[model samples]
Target chain A: MKRRLFLASSIAAALAGCSPIGTALNDNAGFHHALGLEGSLDAALMENLPGLAREYSIADISKNFPVDSLPTPTSVTYDRLLAHDFQSYTLAVVGAVERPLSLSLAQLQRMPQQTQITRHDCVEGWSAIGAWTGVPLRRILQFARPHRDARYAIFRCMDRDDQGTPYYESLDMAQAYQAQTLLALRLNGEAIRPDHGAPVRLRVPTQLGYKSAKWVREIQIVGSFAHLYGGKGGYWEDQGYEWYAGI
Target chain B: MQRLVYRYALLTRLAHWFGAIAVAVLISSGLQIFNAAPYLDAADRSTPTRRVLSIDSPADGIGRTTIFGHSFTTTGFLGWGSDGNGGEGARAFPGWLTIPAYQDLADGRRWHFFFAWIASLAWLSWLVSSAVKGNLAEMILRPSDLHKLWPMQAYYLRLRRDPPPHGSYNPLQKAAYTFVLLVLAPLILLTGLALSPGIDAIAHPLTMIFGGRQFARLWHFVGMLLFVGFVCVHIFQVLTQGFFNQMRSMISGWYRLREHESVGP
Candidate 1:
């Protein structure tokens, strides 16, 4: 009877130790907010404050950077803007901000710019290094003067899927204000090509490539992403990817 | 008369089963992750190779796995293939062998990370407990063990009729377990961390040690293969030595000693 009791307790202990299993099951059910919260906790505990992704030297840049194909915007407005080489392109900044602004590409170029050589890690198990020049996302957010309640910066893209759902993504306030996060305009000392999310794309060096939305049109600051499309978070997050894809 | 003796400690038994379950789950879920991006390429796929050992066709970018001058089109099985949905897809390892049993990269990552955390923590705890209990001393290789290993190997090869004089473990067993505990386990954990971009942000040195994240990924895959090899040999040994007796020791901490064997102090 003693042996039986020991065995029972051991099994119970083993089962109880597997708390992450519950989180894993929750993630599968499209309620990955719990995992996101866990990730945030881990970041706080394990990472240094204002965590900086590893930067590479100019020599480390790949000769042929692998580019994932970004869908060209099929919208008539996008076509008209593209015809004039995006001269009329004005990035609309709105929602949960004290000052709403519409800044053109030339106006954004006048802002303070940062250039850094960093590796872009793709979710498909590939990585490439490239030198990027862009305005810091934090600088833009500061200019917009986000309201105190604004916790997330939602990126609305010009491109849409077959179902006409616009490609969109969001970053938590902490990530949005990261030093390495940029609204990259140039790659390899040249304007980004159509295949590389031309005009303007997000450069979140610390996160996976998918987190960096391409062909950006508007920036929407929100208190929470609870009522956003599909309500999970980003476009891919709605399609089952984790919103906190820091890994 | 059969004699029953205490073989494993309670902690050892618990850790052993816990590790076994963790590894099984890790390997299956890991395969699912691998299926998302399976190829290991040092150069662009378009780069032309010397025709001598290359079975790659320029028309189709698929490369074949070569062994001992024999080449096989392994793309269908190993690196990239159909998603079983009547459309061409890139996936390594079949759905049946993976955790979710489908091509869901996001879900695969969740399962992998969940078990990885459990396995790594359990490993660290086991290491500490073993060190405190002097289990490491018993497991570590000694000069005397080197002499015993030859005869043990000879016995397994059927050149010798008698087993070597044994303590808690034979020399070969000690060496294998020690390598797994000290070498492979730590390397696997480090490479796993190296593969994570978030971890790299905080611990860049760790990622650099493995020559960057993609290289770390390649090494992680190789490590998984080695672990699978180790498991196969371990199970084979258990079956050959005394399946019931060996399993009983791990499960219940009591082993029925063989007729010729003597219990250790």
Candidate 2:
């Protein structure tokens, strides 16, 4: 009897935690979406469908179906990413820098640290709080010492939308300069999974969680965010989510 | 000699006492719920609400009391009767942390929830034992309970307590407790789990079961209505029942019956 009680209690607790961080973070919005008042799934599926059919030409049905249109909740695996292997992962801190050089993941880890328990606010509206740890973004920018012209920190990721739209997000240089900003390498006391931007992601508190882009491949210290796709600088922005999902 | 016959069983007594304590804490924390909704409390919380929460609690140095939803111990210094209903600007918890807490309202709500699981388990165990030994009515209900529910409602509405030995529990009392345990508690748990965001794969199915978060939220509100109804009915019953006799049964597990024998064979 006691054993049954214990099992039931533990299972309930486990069920409560079933939401993985990504989907879990968006639960509030997910709930609304489930009710048809909001829809992340439909948005995701429809967002990718057109390019999906185009990518899987009748000619290359096998390759394109596997890559572009197979699923709704599929993990964005690292092998498909050009810099999936952290050993080979390289990030070029360029632009206003006095010294522009490519560095490996190990080299980046050797830099200074910043940790914050920030909320990851998805456009869908649920949020999750996790402690993020990484090098202070401002310290890196200070090293870069942007010319007076520099205004934005353009982030490019290893993954991209099918239209060859690279997953990129930008922080206003001033926001990036906040000590809390970081090239986060860990989440909730653990190294990140490839699906969650294995080598590096941005951790910025205050802004909605999605701004903490994962799979960071490049950090270009630039004067303008003009050239980024849709001129909004991120993957979901091209998909019609608001540019700033604060709160 | 006035001897006491056993009424509430030992385990049940334990469960009841714990459940009472839990409710007390929840009601205390519930101040946070009201404070969260800023439009409600118009006046400041520092001053007591003489209008609604005029707690006629005995002067301290006795036991415990709740005024304005804050706890007052026998010691007077700790009691800060900040009425959550009277003012809006003052907060129950810091603002930024509060909403995110609701975002995971299912999380800490789990603390409240798990105890409910224990409460249910404890109740069921007690109930099964009572049913097996044929002591169910003594513990759960009695023939007198029928008239008890709506009985004092009339007296309370009119202000008279002529017919006193009105039985174990009023129909209003029976229904209120039953609904909170059977309906509101379960609805709160299910809807809470549904709001869990799709963490558990089963959470997705729960969304489907409840029709979605908005629908679950609606169901939760319905359960809250049942609770509010029960509350109104419960307070009315309390007023109708002689406060001392009924309260003694609740607090000390012994009701001092005027009659020489127990009702019902």
Candidate 3:
């Protein structure tokens, strides 16, 4: 009887410890932040972590890298830029910065650059490898000189959804400052095509594909994403996808 | 008269039940994720020569199931479905079998990762404890034990009524347990880690070894199916051998041995 009682109690304790109910409750409260494993595992993995994404050789690149569903820019500003071959286009760097600068494509390309062949894993269960060439996001952040209170870097995209809400994504300071994170201008030795994120796109190798905001138009440094569109971190994130998307 | 013998330790029993629950959760939630992208394109016709399985849908954007070169429309049941309003939807596994039972991929992932962590921890602890307790030796098959498997199979097939001389575990049981613990469990965990984008970045070689992330996902799905099959067979065997006795042994750590039975050497 004593043994049975002990076994019963131990099993009950184990079940309680292993239950998802507690985690689900915490998730519902938004105390955990992000979505799914992103809030837990991704956050834990990024805590004070140094550059985590690995670079691959050019030989490892996939011949046919998948082009994710690209949204065409319907705004007049984007259409005018596209009409003029993006010659008059400028990337605006704003919010929580000492020097809020607007950089043209050529000017941005002149900055210190890094090229990496990395794998892009989609959350929907596909992977593609490609060679990405561009300036490191850390260099851009350094140029912007983010304020001490700035905790997140938000990417404002030119693309809009069916509702005309502009697509946007954000990265925590740690990820933004990662060595591999880039504002990619080229893929596979050529200028990025329209099917892929053309002109420029954020390439966060550590994150899932959706976190790499395509057709980036603006960069905003913010302390919190509470006032942003939908309050969640990204376009997909607002619609139930995980914001941290590291996996 | 029957002799009461200790068949399982408290920790072992606890681990067994814990592992079972963890696997159940993992499998169901995994199916939910699989439903998100259900098509497997073994041949990327774009490249013509390069053959690799992809989770991307075919040209028509409709998911298909191919068996020995015969293809069938698996959209509604397999990869895509109706959103309950006659609109096109994506549903992999049915709602009842999934963790959230809704189309929330994020929630499904949380449930999966939560249980995956628990299961992995339990498995590691079980391995360490089993080693310390010298239980590993009993679980492994001996050269002579190979001979016993035939007779056990014959008995199971009803060719012989009497059960082979009682042992800690029958040859078939040992084989099944060994496969589950040493093979399927490790494969599932490794493949799962390979599928994680964050983990893949750190451990590129692990994913590369499996060809890619999609391949890892495919193998992980296959592993879940194998695990379900194993559980079904395990329960059936338990019921046929003596349901109450097996249940009592696992629950109470004591099994009543028949008078004619002798523990194996």
How many clashes (backbone N, Cα, C below 3 Å) per candidate?
A: 0, 18, 1
- The TM-score between candidate 3 and the true structure equals 0.83
Specify the highest-TM-score model's number.
Answer: 1
Q: Chain A alone, TM-score for each of the models?
A: 0.82, 0.63, 0.82
Model 1 C-alpha lDDT per residue in residues A1-247, reported as the tens digit of each score: 5644565576556443443353345445455544445455454655445568888788778778777744787678877877888899888999999999899999988898899888888886777888999999999999899999888999998878888888899998889998999999999999887668779999998888888899998999999887989997789888767677676
Per-model C-alpha RMSD: 6.4, 20.9, 6.2
Residue A69 accuracy (lDDT) in model 1: 42
Greater-lDDT candidate between 2 and 3: 3
| Model 3: pairs clashing at backbone N, Cα or C within 3 Å | B35-B92
Task: Give the per-residue lDDT of model 1 (tens digit) for B37-85.
Answer: 6545333111112112222222243536543346677665543454534
Preferred candidate (TM-score higher): 2 or 3 = 3
Interface RMSD of 2: 17.6
**DockQ, each predicted model:** 0.30, 0.03, 0.29
lDDT of 3 at A103: 93
- Winning model by lDDT: 1
**Span of ten consecutive residues with least summed lDDT in model 3 chain B:** B43-52
Candidate 3 per-residue lDDT, tens place, B7-126, comes to: 788888888888888887787678667766654433211221342332223544475555445566776555454332335555555454565555666766776777787899889888
lDDT of each: 0.75, 0.49, 0.74
